[model samples]
Target: MPVCPYCQVEMDDDLDTCPNCGITMIYFFKCQRCGQEFATTGILKFCPLCDADLSEQMN
Candidate 1:
């Protein structure tokens, strides 16, 4: 499960729109080294696949 960024509510991975906040979800994290995109809880500082520093790529 992933938490909705807007409403801070837990949601299913298959959902594109948040059920609690009605906001469209986007994979806000993108790795500059591997070009991988994912949604995170702000605890991850590196790309899971390439180990690239994702501290600055929060958009």
Candidate 2:
């Protein structure tokens, strides 16, 4: 299972992206506003906290 860095919530590890925050997988990603530690596969673009767009928020 995967853990949401923003909320520390448990999620499915196979998720290519987070359903709640839209974060990727593997790489280190932190909520720009809240400063939470998350892993991203480098394919998302939203903070999920303040709903801000990440570098890759859209597909």
lDDT of each: 0.75, 0.65
Q: What tens digits encode model 2's per-residue C-alpha lDDT throughout 1-49? A: 7688776767774576778887655665666667766665654577756
Model 1: lDDT of residue 4 = 84
For model 1, residues 1-59, the per-residue Cα lDDT tens digits are 87887889998766778898888775567788988878753346788999998778543
Off by over 4 Å in 2: 27-59
Best by lDDT: 1
Q: Each prediction's TM-score against the native?
A: 0.46, 0.37
* Model 1 TM-score, 2 decimals: 0.46
